[model samples]
Target: MNDGGFSALVVLDDLAAPRFSPGAAELLALMDSVADACPLDSAALHAQASAELGLGDFGPRDYEERLEVLLAAYRDAPRLSRAGRVNLHAQFLQLLKNRLLFTDLLRREPGIAGIELAPPVVIAGLPRTGTTHLLQLLAATGRFRTLPYWEGLEPFPLPGEAGVVPEPRRERTQAAVALMNDAMPHFARMHEMADADHVHEEIALLASDFSTMYFETLTEVPAWQEYYAGHDQAPHYRYLRLHLQALQHLRPGPAGAGRWLLKSPQHLEQLPVLAETFPGATVVITHRDPVHVVTSMATMVAYTDRMFSDPTDPAGTGRRWAARIERMLDALQRDRSALPPDRAVDLPFADLMADQLGAVERILAMAGERFDAAARSGAEAYLAGHAAGHLGRVDYRPELVGLDPDDLRRRFASYERRFLPSEEPLPVDN
Candidate 1:
């Protein structure tokens, strides 16, 4: 996805795979020009990572295991571009730096451990379902402090770094975004981002734990994916809380009191753990027809993977991601009763987009929060000034990704009956 300081991808046409711009192509060729070692040496990489961060106790020993799997992926994956390799390396270094710096902060300032968080406001949904749009609206209210793109990229400051000074990574992030956009112009249509973009994904912070959906977005590594699935993600969520506390301690919230406003598609399946990590969290789950969810998400993944692959599997992407979404739905359904009724709410994408502020008001009301005049006015202004970015009216056929409408409908039948009864029914033939 977005490498270094940014993350994500989409845009489609007549081919099984999208074409790279000439500049992007030339850049990839140059990256391939000077070949180096394959399957980067894990020990050497760790040593380099250690040196990169001024050498600290990188906390738990678990991340190194993930590093091995990732290195194996780079070495084995065929047709990976040189630029793709460079991006992956940059991402790994960032994660290691995050782990070192974050742990160092906690060790030196145990008071950071005491930084209290109100039950956070979490926006959960399938991708492209107005989740990001909602977070932006809420963030504009100036009532919550969100995880900005820069914080997620680095997550913590250096050993003795603090103050309201200019961001240390500001120039580097802008340069990276420029280079990425300059090479692949289509990126803007996929998911727009900048160095200071607010309401960033939680997956970026998960990378510090070396357990994240970020890797899944970048490549097709079944072993790694399987390993991730089998493990207990509660530990990762535990680390997630620590990182959030660290962020709050580093940059005191608005007026010395504001909750964390976090969003991610990955949260759909981890609701239980999320609830455990932050008790009484106000969780908002957004729904869209699974048919749209699968195909669109596949396109997003297609764009990012294409940077690292050629002849990517659109249909396979469809099938795998479709299954994953359905599984998440199933998990949510199973755990629905476990969540506190007053603390949870559901919003349909169509409704949220139609009246974004109203939908948020409904959500806040359910969480026992007030939608004050200031919030209403701020959201109205945000909507008046900004519009959803244009994604041209190009067709995205489900069959192209090997998905059958009826089959997907059956797969998501329970989800529909539970949360989308009044919504548009899936187009399926008996």
Candidate 2:
């Protein structure tokens, strides 16, 4: 893949070709051979979760329908390889255990439901549109309650796991992070990640409800996507609020911890739901040229797809993600008015890249939070430690994904006109 005039730093100069390392290949082979042991059957998964957690109640039976539908889709999915099945089964089981743990916690401590939550500040945008970086900067300010990547993996601590030293949850997450980095070294270059304390999207919480775009990230699942699109996600969004409350109750933060800071691309398509779930939230929408978004997203998808499926279809990934972005943009444009004008902030990619602290200050102002000395110090520290492109840079070419820049520009014309700056020059396709 050729660089599309986006980055100059080349820390990984030897990675001219895109292929999985030998270690990764061997690991995938082992996983494929053991695929039969990790069945994708919903019944088997539910039993395993209950057995593991010693909890039987799954909160509500409504989620069962969604789970069944998802499992069926996975079973019938054409492109899902054996390794994909094993990996997805593990993810599915973890979510099942998460659901069980939450239900058990709520049953024991009914007060968790009564815990009031302050309105959150949410960042809504597509991937590669400065969402992750903005989330990190704001989180660094130490003014808002945010979900860590480790907590997102397992929201509820396992039974008898409270007040323990070193935090078992964090240790497990660190191991997982190391394994992923070893398997896909270039991932951090495209999207930076951390072990315990990195800011993560609430999309992980939404996964317990079995209604999120996260599933589609693994491989092509058109039926699951169609099913997800047909349903109203308001209930699931409310479920996400409940998860947040439980998290707050489990680990009580400072007095102002009620005001959560959240970001997720899923929020782009669920603007109305987000507004309903967390009223008076400061909604920040980040804008970038759809061409750049599609190119970078397709490249990341193909790179990660090696762990599950073989013979990456960059062209198909580009087409699917382009359509997905189009739908999210349409939903955003239509329902943006759902949020009050006073609580809305539109941040262009160029502006954020040009002056990150300025963008953070603007967002904090919109959220009615002061950009005081502490906030400034934290933001500056984060900037110094995690400079952009520090991990390295990947040269993403639209042609590698069979994407035509002109066509993408035409397709996203209305969105660009509405949100992006008119004077922003078109990105060159090398």
Candidate 3:
């Protein structure tokens, strides 16, 4: 059941003013010296990944320019702590390594390219719009291939790990999750991260192509953001599809299984590319009040920013995401018609909260999937085990995040009127 703001569970630490543990702070400070020694150089990182993986090819060279642009943006990122720089370097290097592994797999098994993919059920929506819950419920139905968090971290296994029991990828991901929980203790309240087996978006696949909004979560990089905005993402979307094909080829499930179930807030602005990439896909666009979305998003981003930077600015986060979301909405308003009406479903957040199972039924129906007894039972079990707000709560202060409720409502009035009319009272997360 949904916890609509009134929960006896512990309220999480304040995001407006994050308090780091003395031990954690000392560890971070110690890591800074080691991190400062590693610079964010694209060429060096590429060469390192090549040397480590014993692979010379990284698929296509088209992504090199974008990687270069992102590195330069990281160089210009403001107030980026040494630890943050270290994190960025590690992340980029891992992405490069993943690319190498993927390209190598494609090279070894040329037949992988011939593997056909079923039309996926894609969820496109902003953060805080119940997209994660919807994806989890659908995945529980055992009706689609979903990417687990561990797989998202490293899609391909290391050399000599094929056919190995108890994947090392999962164990490594579990360790990373523990470290992240210690660093950002309250993040689970805002976004679920308690388990490595949880469902994750395909944004990581997009990052392999060096074209995604995942970087912004670490810290603001307007230069990279601008570059990302100016590029055509269809090729990257194709790259994502190639990886999906590879994953399916690497691990072929029982014959005649369901389609892939995927979700990403990034797709809210890339509906056209999504449609073009996955023809005949079931596109579900979840809707919520923009004011509430912005406030919640701002708080979460600001909270996560503390891990990478000291003294995060909540107001700046609020303002930046507010504008960023507005641009997404504008793009949605412009490109929504790109999706065929029969294959698209509009899901309001209030309706999802009001009838979670019912929403699943509707979404499944839209995707031409049956809501069998097994599916319902699985979904019910998932809901029972994963109640909202069970991980505690966070006090969302819009004022502290430089958000005015009235002004926000007015700013998003057009979007509200278009998608969530006044008749449907929006549920408040509080």
> For model 3, which pairs clash?
none
Name model 3 segments beyond 4 Å from true. 1-17, 253-256, 423-430
The best-first sequence of candidates by TM-score reads 3, 2, 1
Candidates in order, TM-scores: namely 0.89, 0.94, 0.95
Clashing pairs in 2: none
Q: Tens digit of lDDT per residue, candidate 3, span 365-425?
A: 9888989998899899998977876666766768878888898888888899899984556
lDDT of 1 at 403: 80
Candidate 2: deviation at residue 416, Å?
0.9
lDDT of each: 0.72, 0.84, 0.84
Rank candidates by lDDT, best first.
3, 2, 1
Candidate 1's residue-wise lDDT over 186-257, tens digit each? 555555564465458778888888786668788676667777778778989888888888888777777623
Lowest summed lDDT across 10 adjacent residues in model 3 is found at: 1-10
Which candidate has the highest lDDT of all?
Answer: 3
Best by TM-score: 3
Candidate 1 yields a Cα-based lDDT of 0.72
Query: Against the correct fold, how does model 1 do in TM-score?
Result: 0.89
- The positional error of residue 229 in candidate 3, measured at the CA in angstroms, is 0.8
